[model samples]
Target: MGIFLPNLLVIGGVLILPWVLMLFNYAWWRPKRLERALKKQGIHGPPYKLLSGNIIDEFRALKASHAKPMGLSHHILPRVAPFHLQTVKNYGKTSVTWFGTDPRVNIMDPELIREVLSNKFGHFTKPPPTSLLKQLVTGLVTHEGKKWAKHRRIINPAFHVEKLKRMLPAFSTSCNELVSKWEQWVGSEESRELDVWPDLQALTADVISRAGFGSSYKEGKRIFQLLTEQSELIMQAVQTAFIPGYEFLPTKGNLRRREIVREVKAILKSMIEKREKAMKTGEADNDDLLGLLMESNFKESQEQGNSNSMNIEDVIEECRLFYFAGQETTSSLLTWTMIVLSMHPSWQVQAREEVLQVFGENKPDIDGLSHLKIVTMILYEVLRLYPPAIFLTRCTYKRMQLGGINLPVGVQLALPVLLIHHDPELWGEDADEFKPERFSGGVSKATKNQVSFFPFGWGPRICIGQNFAMIESKLALAMILQRFSFELSPSYVHAPYTVVTLRPEYGAQLILHKL
Candidate 1:
């Protein structure tokens, strides 16, 4: 019996040794197979490291480079690495880089971006593994396949032109409040150097609350604060999560992120539950985004006879997305526009003149806003310069051909929207310079009849709220221009970075002059 026991132990050890070694090789020693594949195809980038790939080294280089004083152009590079922007520039427009174990990167070619965004459900889909972000917000933005189709179908009506027209009143009210506040600051004083960043943030939050939730700014403001806090923590996690085992450690930032997520979810839940109850009792008001979405979703669910059409949880997720996406995009657009206008007072004067011509001394209505062509051009130019969402990403589910390259499955594509928007080849030699007149004849003419301008994205999955955002932005711009002339304050630091969206790292400060 003793001899048999010894033999059994020996056999078990012998069998387990090879498996353990194989696991180790898979985790650490194996060369990044994707990097090798790219090299073999005559594509090359900075050499990859073992398991961590180029993340740590690339980030170090990026941080060092960014530490120096740089113009608006340098902000386009990787402020933190996987030096994606530099890598793409070095390895041609369509190139790949390693994000830890993941093989992903910039597909700067306009055609490829079009293919990925337009041909949804073909070779790519929204990557399913979104870490903890999916738990916080998973509405139309993250959904795919049949789920996306259904959500898109139900949510479409809420953002239709007529629907947006109804929400214009909400937009005007928010803009009025903002103008009133700014007026107070400019009372009897020729000018006041105000940080328009916070004001824009508050204004957008108010718009989303009144336009999206049918609730007052007070409720929406609370949600916006929580969302902003949550986004900051998430951005930090994304920066460090590329390192191995970083997420598992209960760091201060991670704990705070979890808390923020919890608070946001709780707030969303209470609002949704209350709205749902009110809806059931026929006391729901369709004044804001929440009410409209709920009312639309409930009716659709009943009509479809599917219990899953638009549940309370789904409605809450949509609301969360609205708060984050809607508010952030508009705020970024307005802030950058203000800065650019300040830089070129000529354009600012032109835009303000156009606004005054359209709606002098009275609130601009939706119809009046549509005719403000110069304002639209300036906004489009601002969007080109500092697109709110810097990049869009997709994961390949099957081996597919993109721009004549045979892309293998599991390869992730990072389509840098800002890079594409700012590409000299696409937008001409003066791409980096701010010139609103380039868009005088609309986007098609702006790009010399190319399909390169996609601020809200492209194809089937383009932002559903794009029209709503545009109208809201135009209205807000007109209102601000009508009341005040502003310029970047001397103390303002022009540090633009991506934190879920392209944001001025230091808040955009400007001196507001009462017109």
Candidate 2:
């Protein structure tokens, strides 16, 4: 028994001890060391707490900020991200904070942000995705290095301008359905009050489903519905993620999230299999996103060999991305655009006038959309004010020099896009005000070619589907403006928040006057 006990102790020292030491380093020692290093470099923020660090503080701030809705104002950073606002206010723009044991340094400077995002030597990379986040989507958004480049190359063809031109029919069809429903709701009555948030959500989903899967749109819609539920669960998980293995707990929400992921994958697998078989048989029209992706994948396999081609699992993840990112970005943009236009009726009128002058009663074509100067200006302003994504985060894996700061490995650099977009110094004293004219001279003139305004991100990793999103938004907005003159309904509450993307927390209620 004494010999067995000694052997067990030796085994523990050899195996479990290293893991324990590593955990201690990650959860305690490393953070303290990083904190000291940052402080020495003149970067300071909230003091780090053992294990939980600033996560609990962040949660408290978030809960307090979101307890009630704000007034009708464009200055939404405080409500949308209270903790970040407070940290930046306390420690200057490029300051540090903790997300669990990791140090998060907020970089509100546009030029530094450009360097981080551009990632010239690949020092900064996308932060590893959490398990809950993976439930929402993966593929390109989560991948890095060679995998990201490969996937991006394969997916590029699907979003080319010529390809988007082909998908215009899908965009138009989706908008037509929305117009029809709203028309029916306003039926014979001069005006009707309705909450447009869910309707817009549905519209973007429908467009993605149609454009992504073509004949398998019904299946795609089912997958998106599950994805929506999964996203909600993920947000809930985000609040308590400091608890290790929180996602694996046998809780109702976690179980439901698992179920949702399984269902979505199953549906996507069936749809993909059918599409692949049809394509091989030459019975499929390779026009939609999924078909185009497969065609691209096939060509890539032929050119670069099968090893470089995305496998079935990779294809599935990309499809999930197609639905999640494609729908979330455009829906959030359209919803905010509607709410903003409602707030400023003058701009709405001007946008509608521009739309009318460009297309009259005709459906908006791709060329006409480009000429929508006023409408384009409004969309840009909306994106600046209530960007669908509030911030972008990159982590340093190896020691890197960013600006004047020496960022240590394992430190996260947060580009607070919301703050950058609303900086008075950058956008004048009326930065918070709704003014589309700031964009009238075009984005390059507006920021003098700085990466100050990156709603779709910037550089090599900029969203591939940006053109698709803008085209869809322009088409949807033009159609809505042509069919209806809308204003904020009395029931509308100005509660902007984030759940994967920035959104109107209580839905956008507007009175639609049928024109």
Candidate 3:
């Protein structure tokens, strides 16, 4: 009896005690402490429940909201982010919502949002994705502090304006191919009712292939296709991510995600091997993104005596970043630009006129692209209205006070870019309206030099590929304007939704008039 009792006690201590502690910390103590802290600061959210916290309610709300598309209006906040809109209405901008037990403070104030993103002290860091989701892609976007700085420094040379100018031919080539394909379908004086959405995605993907990997898109087309599938898988995983141990289960989704990531890694590995061999033979000049990155990494390690050069795995991740981020940003920007321009022909005419006057009957060069004032203004306005990334998130690693609210460690801040962009107080009465004139004087002038316009993000860790994406977008728009004038088709449905990035729920169908 004595031996059995001792054995039972040891077993209980080994298993049950930790479970009890986990329950105590994760379920009860954390929620109440966070709630009390926020409440004392006069910031209250919906009541937090144990275990699930606010996740169940949030999921239900999202499911119901996404049941059907909303009306066609510029006030897209309600459609894209119904939960956020409703929460703000109920609990005010500074309320704390629960993503599991972790309190995600809804930071609507632009100043506070800027403070977190700027992260001067590096106390705030990006919340890491789920372990399974990390398999999707982990690049500089997901890095922090020293790692982020190292990666940024190495990758910076690849996207410099001079290097990008070298890539203009690749951009023009892809655009020319897209235009030619459209021309075949569109004889003189005939309009083609086409969905520019998929076509633009293909165009950007092809550009990334040729410019990013120094090969025709056909060689790298598989990468784009796989990445797209992975993105869809990620969106599914994210909905259930808040549930503990959910990803561990070998469900179809989890299996597929694993398989997809494995395949993607294998593909990237093969490409990197070939490129590395070519570089060793002194056959490449680091022109394309992958080559530039490997060269930059090597030069840094050799010249600066820094061993912080990215490994083969890091290079692969960056390539993933280039393919996914590069393609998504430009494609969304181009697709929406077409839709908005179609809606407002005057702006379209003005932009096309600027493109033509700058470079008449000739290809768009870097010089002419730089001088496209009207086109730049139009793109800036579209970014303001429908930023590709709808929100930027950061979490506190140490207890910190922000905008006068004391936040506990592990608390997240949701800086909803779309909400802040559409705020009337910041952008004047016509904030929701499409007014490229608001940016007539540029982004700094638009926000009165405040951090109000951050479609690509702001501060030290702003998106490194912003210039690359912009130049690619400008080239596509310029080429398209030169070739065709398009208007929204009657069959087009206006349904903007977020699938990682804000996209039209229904495809962007437009009638192209060959110009």
Candidate 4:
């Protein structure tokens, strides 16, 4: 018994000692060394606390920001990114904050954001999600390295501009239904007061349903509804993820998120299997996004003889991504466009004139949407002022030099898109104004050669569904302008907050007048 006990003790030390030392290294030594290095380089930020670090502070900041509504102004930096804004304001643009033991540097410089995002050698990649959070999302957005490369290859064809043009009918049909529904609701009143937020959500959801999944909106809307719930739950989990053992607590939010994720996965799997069966029976048109993805995957594998095709789970991940991304980005863009255009009626008038000139009372065609220069400008301006995603983050696994500062491994880079978008230094004197003229020439010309404007994101890893979103937005906006002229309702409260994406905190109620 004594001999066995000694052997057990020896084995325990062999296993536990290295891990304890590694924990000490990770939780103390390395962080301190990195902090001193950063401080020496003049990069300073809020001082960190033990294991909690800045997480509690960050949580408080987010809570305080979202606690009450703000004035309806173009300045959204403070509202959408309270913590980062306060940190930047207090500690300059390039400052550090602790995410647990890891130091996350806030980089407000456009050049630095561009370099990190356009990383060619994979020096920077998105930090892995927490174990619980990973279940909420996956696919290309979460992938890196060669897996990302292959997925991009197989998915590119599905989002090609020409392919998106073919999907215009789906966009128009959903939009037409929304227009008809709104028209019916307005009846004969000079104007109608209605919360268009939910309607817009449904419209975008239906568009994604028909265009993405090759099914009726009624059939696919569950995915949208559940995914929306999932986003909120995901945010809840993100806020509390740093709390060790939080996932095991069986909290209501935790249970709800887990439930929502399961529902989403099951729905996606069933739908994907249905499409796969249809394709095998030669009964599918291969037009919808999912069908096209399958066709593309098959064609690539057959032509190139590559056996490394994405599995069913991988395809489901892509579907989830497409569903969430396709819905969120366009819906946010459209929602903001509606609200902003309502605020500035003159621009709305001009955009309507442009749309009318391009397509009149007819449905907007793919070709004519290209001629919607004014509408395009307005859309770009909204993206600049109220981008759907306010931040982009990248992490390093090796010590490296970036933007004249040396960063150690395990350091995270926080690229605040909204801060850079709203910067006066980069965008000029009227940076806060809602002026579409800045982008009249183009994005490159708008920023005057700075990496300032990337509403859809910048670099090779930029949003692949950008064309689809743009086309969908143009068709919907063209139709909305054709049918109604709207202004902010007296009851409308301008509350824009980020729940995964920038969204109207209060429902967007508008006073709509039939043209």
Where in model 2 is the C-alpha error above 4 Å? 1-16
- lDDT (Cα, tens digit) per residue for candidate 4, span 182-261: 99899998689999988888888999999998764565799898888888777767766666678878789888887887
Candidate with maximal TM-score: 2
Could you give candidate 3's per-residue lDDT for residues 420-464 as a string of tens digits? 899888998899899999888888789987778898888988888
Per-model C-alpha RMSD: 2.7, 1.6, 1.9, 2.2
Error of 2 at 410 (Å): 0.9
- Give me candidate 4's TM-score against the actual structure: 0.94
> What is the per-residue lDDT of model 2 for residues 40-80, given as tens digits with 9 covering 90 to 100?
99999999988788888988888899897688999888888
Pairs with backbone N, CA or C atoms under 3 Å apart (clashes), candidate 3? none
Residue 442 of model 3: what lDDT?
Answer: 81
The number of clashing residue pairs in model 3 is: 0
Predicted structure 3: lDDT: 0.86
Task: For each candidate, give its TM-score against the true structure.
Answer: 0.92, 0.97, 0.96, 0.94
Higher-ranked by lDDT: 2 or 3: 2
**The 10-residue segment with the lowest total lDDT in model 1:** 73-82
Candidate 4: stretches off by over 4 Å: 1-23, 67-69
Alpha-carbon local distance difference test for all models: 0.79, 0.91, 0.86, 0.86
Off by over 4 Å in 3: 1-10, 304-306
lDDT of 1: 0.79
Report the number of the highest-lDDT candidate. Answer: 2
